[model samples]
Each structure stands twice: as C-alpha cells, then as structure tokens.
Target: MGERVLVAHQPAYWPWCGYFSRLLDVDELVLLDHVQFSERGWQHRNTVADRYGRPVRLTVPVRRDFGQRLTEVRIAEPDFRERHWRTLSETYRRAPHFNRFADRLQELYAQSWTHLVDLNEAVTRLILDALDLKVTLVRTSGAPPSGTKTAALVDLCRRHQADVLRVGTGAGAYLDAGLLERAGIRIEVAAYAPTPYGRARSRPAGLSVLDLLMHEGPRARAVLMAGARTAPFTSTPREVHA
Candidate 1:
C-alpha cells in the first residue's frame, strides 16, 4: 500500500492557489469545520484581482455568535450571492477564460446557502473538481472527536490511518512536532512557492483560485503544482474546455 498522507485545514472562502497547492500532494483532506469561526479570517472572505488589476477582497457577510463553530455560522446577508456574483462578473468579465467558467460560477452563486461552512465547502469542491484533483475530502464535524489543538490534529491523522500529516509552513508556529512524533505520525511541512500565471499587468501574490482559473484556464492546475515540495498525485493533466 502507498503512504497515506493527510492534510487538514479550515475551509476558506474561495481559497487561494496555495490552498489547492497543499491539497495536490495529499491523499486525503479534512476540512476542519468544527473549529470556531473567525470573522477576520479567510473562512468568509478572499482576495481577487479587480478590473484594474488591483487586489480586492470579496467577503461573505455572516451572522456571528460569541462561540459559533464554522458549520453553525449563518449568512447575515441574503443578497451576498447576487453581490458577489456581480463583483466577479464586473471584475473578471474581461479575463481570458472567465466566460469558460462563468456559467457554472453563476450556478454556484445562485444556490441558497444559509450556512458559511456549506458555502465555503461548495466552492472548495467546485475548485477541486475544476483542478481535477482526486483527494478524498473529509469534514471534521463528522469525524471522531480528537481532543483539541495539536492533539486533535494527531487524532484526526490516526483516525484516517495517515502515516504522514502534511501541513503548511505557517503551522510550524502552533503545531508541536514532539506531540505528533509521539503519536507516530510523521510531519511534513509544505514549502510552496506560488507559480506566476496569466497576462495581467499587475499580478497579486495570493488571489483566490477563481483568479487563477479565469486567467490560466486549462493550465491552472499545472501552474498550481509547479513549485510544490511534493509531487501531485496525478501527472496527467485534465483539459479545461470552454
């Protein structure tokens, strides 16, 4: 049997290229939806390039509670769907491959999503499908309880039978290496250098996957996997036809 690698992260709204880059190398991905929702975090917003090629943030307005799990957070504004779609249309209509994905994009936005986690997961899945990534996705909300912090992470790995726990470099600050090692899980910190794509004059470093797709089209997945520390699961590229 091949090495079982598990990667887990909060399901970010319209996640950036680096998010997909991390997924490229993993066998399974667990969306940590049981975690507390943060208002200022990427759980409800992400950056994109505007019509003028400047980075702009597109956010989903959510009703907040003092201690709400991400899966429990509700959308504060019902019109967020129309507003976000309009923003994307106005900003990216001129992008090379925008029309290619526009129909499906519009369909996604048209769905009535009441919870923040549902919306984020829907979009994440859409982007993953577009990238042709085949990793199995799991949600922590449905998984067995795994204590808290690093302990929870290690437990998650154990539950999934992961020999290696892959995490982004940022996790180095918070995740205890000794704890994971003691739990019999090897730690691999992903070193991802973003691969530049598209013909935009002003390229932003970490815009959402939408930006990459609209610009690079069929080549977006290749660009995303270019500089990763580990090789992606599949080398056969899927063609994105308009």
Candidate 2:
C-alpha cells in the first residue's frame, strides 16, 4: 500500500547492532544466500568483547567447495558451537542482561546445524526475533539469478518488486546507479553509526549486537536505531561493522 523499501545482505554470524539497524525501516530483506562464499568475511564469524575490554573473534570453520555458493558451504567442525557457547558464557555472564537472552541462545547453540549459511541464517533469525523486526525474507539460493554484481541485484529488486534498494556505502563500488534507475528502483543509503554502549573503542564500534544485548538488553533496539539512518546513495566506503 506504500513505497516498499528492501535491503539485501549475506547472512552474518552474531551480527552487530548495525546489521539489525539495516532492517529498522525496511519492508523486506533479501538474504543473498546464493552468493559465493568469502573466507575473510563476516558470514561465518564475528567479534565479541571480553570482560577485560578486549576484542575476541569467534569464527566458525567452514568447508567450502570449489566455487560453492554460501548455501552449499558446510560447517567443518562439530565442536565449534560448544566452544562458542562457552566463550560467550565466559565473556558475558556478568553482563547485566545476559540472563534475559542466555536460555534462547544456549538452546540455539545446542541444535545441530550442517550448512554454514543455515547456521548464519539461524543466528540472524534469533537476533531478528530478539529485536522484533518484522520484515519479509527471501533467499536466492533456491533460485539465484544468472548474473554477477549489480545486474544480479537489479534483477533481485525487480523480482521482488522493490521500490527502493536500501544499502550501506560498502555496496557503492559494485552498484550501478543508472542500472537501478533504469529498472525503476531507486538506491538509498542506509547505515548504522555506532553509539558507544560501553565496549572497547575499536574498529567495530559495537562488538556485536550480542554484546549490545548483554549490556543494554531491551534497550538495544533504541540504541541501534539511534545511529541508523538512510539517505540517497553516493561514494563507496569501507564497511566497519560485523
């Protein structure tokens, strides 16, 4: 009934506050599950803050097939989940709101997950539910379009009937403004500026939304939206979030 806003990104593990911030005002989210797996990216790992204000990275080992899409990658280790849970418990057990979300997170880690993307999606879903963000989800792994870069994104926009594509500056190098305009989809800049919720002052402003949740609990939603905003798209910028 109104102009539709859409955001698309690969699933991330223990996503940061900014990740959920992207969904704050969008109508739909396209999980780019069909994209090639990146070994160095946040798709399978994220950082959390240690009790002593240190940054600790948690990575999930993934077995990537030759030219495998994200959806096809498998988790390489069985004990990673247990280790991660233990690490979280050790790091955040003293956090003010850890008890509020511990049971759900523990239950999540206890489940069996085979695919890397599935685990990331589950983590995303867990955070989405915790934040109470209501947005439609569409995965391209089941039927990915045949193209690379901007063209594929345009196709996804058209396919989903998205009136506008809301993305962060990191996508600018790969995104073609004219192409989106031709497709009748406008590009808007959406991003999260970190508001310190008492974490190490490092590259990733808020270690992870998980950290934010531990510290701020139900107030995280407000903290997340505090720095989140959208504007007309422009130059490429390096992403600084999990």
Candidate 3:
C-alpha cells in the first residue's frame, strides 16, 4: 500500500498562501477543530489589500468563551458575511482573475453560517479546489483527538493510519519529534518564506491566498508553492517537549 501522508492545522480564515503550500502533497489534511480556540490567531482574521492598495484586516467577531474549542465558537455578528464580501469585492473587483472565482465566493459568503470552523472549512475547500489540490479533508471533530501537543499529533497520525506526519514549520520549535519517531511516524516539516508574487496590490507579503489567486489566477498554485521547502524526517525535533 502506498504510504499515507498527512498534515493538520487549526482551520484558518482565508488563510495565507503558506497554509496551502505544504498541503499540496499530503494524502490527508486534518482541520484541528477540536482544539482550543485562539482569539488572536488567524482563525478569525486575515489581511488583504484595500482599494487604496494598502494592507487591511478583515476580522470575524466571535462570541468569546474562554477555553472553548474552535468547534464550539460561534460568529458573534450576523452581518459580517455581507460586510466581508463587500470588502473583498470592492477591493478585488478589478483583479484579473476575480471574475473567474467571484460568483462561487460570493455565494459562500451569502450562506448563513453559525460555527466559525464551518465557515473556515467552506472557504478553505474552495481555495483548495481553486489550487487543484485533491487531498482528502478531515476534521478532528469527526473523531475526537487524544492528548496535547505532539502526543495529540501522534494520536492523530495513528487514528488516520498515516505513515508520515508532515507538519508546517509553525510548530517546529515545540514538536517532540522523538516521541513521533518512537511511535513509528516519519516526521517532515514544510516551510514557506513569503516571496513576491503577482500583486493583487501593494500590501505587504503574506497576505491571504486570495491575493495570490486574484492576481496570478491559474498559476497561483506555482506561486503559492514557490520557495516552499520541507525538512526531511528528523529523528529529533528542534526542541523537545517536556
């Protein structure tokens, strides 16, 4: 049987291009919906260019409950969809590829959504399709994960029958690779350093994947994957968790 490779992360809002780069090759991508929600994380906010071609943030207000998991978090406002769509449409209306993806994207925003993670999945799926990535999408909400940090990650790999656990470098500093190696999971880390791509605008690098798609269109896949590198399976993590 072919080796099953997997990647997982907290589902994000209109995630930056870096989020999707490493996901391209994985057999499964798990959304960590069962994990605790992060109020200041990208889960509820992302940046894009304004009509004036400057960086602007679109934030989703959530009904805050301390210690609540992402699956339990709810959108605090009802009008955010319309407002966010307006911001996107008004800003990218003139983008070379906006017309190609505008309709479906508009329809997504038009849907009534309650859970923030559900909304995130809807958009991330669309973006993945746009990039032509065929990785199977799963969420921890389907099968509750066990443990915390690397233990949790190893449990996820075992649950999914994954032979390789390919994680983003965001967690590299804290991963307990030795634990995973002992569990018989080969660990690889994917990293992307933001580089200039066709501009949806003059906003700083690391803007949402929308910025890449609107400007680069079909070639956005290559642009998103550019400069992305994966660290080979390391017997040791950069740092060991206690």
Among these predictions, the greatest TM-score belongs to 2
- Model 2 agreement with the true structure over 57-132: per-residue lDDT tens digits: 9999988677888988999997998999999999999988889999998998899999888888788887877788
Report the alpha-carbon TM-score of model 2 versus the true structure: 0.92
Query: What residue runs in model 2 are displaced by over 4 Å at the alpha carbon?
Result: 198-206, 235-242
Across 8-112, the per-residue lDDT of candidate 3 in tens digits comes to 888999999878988877756899999899988999999998656689899998998999999999999979999999999998898889999999889998899
Q: Rate the local accuracy (lDDT) of all candidates.
A: 0.82, 0.82, 0.84
For each candidate, what TM-score against the reference? 0.91, 0.92, 0.91
Steric clashes per prediction: 0, 0, 0
* Alpha-carbon deviation at 178 in model 1, angstroms: 1.0
Q: Estimate the overall C-alpha local distance difference test score of candidate 1.
A: 0.82
| Residue 116, candidate 3: alpha-carbon lDDT | 95
**For residues 1-242, what per-residue lDDT tens digits would candidate 1 score against the true structure?**
88788888998999988788878756567999999999888999999988777888999999879898998999999899999999999999999999899998999999998998888888988898888888777888876455898899888887889888877756656787788888888876665677767885348787898998999888998987785664322123232111
User: Where does candidate 3 clash, by residue pair?
Assistant: none
Task: For residue 98, give model 2's deviation from the true position in Å.
Answer: 0.5
| Prediction 1 TM-score vs. true | 0.91
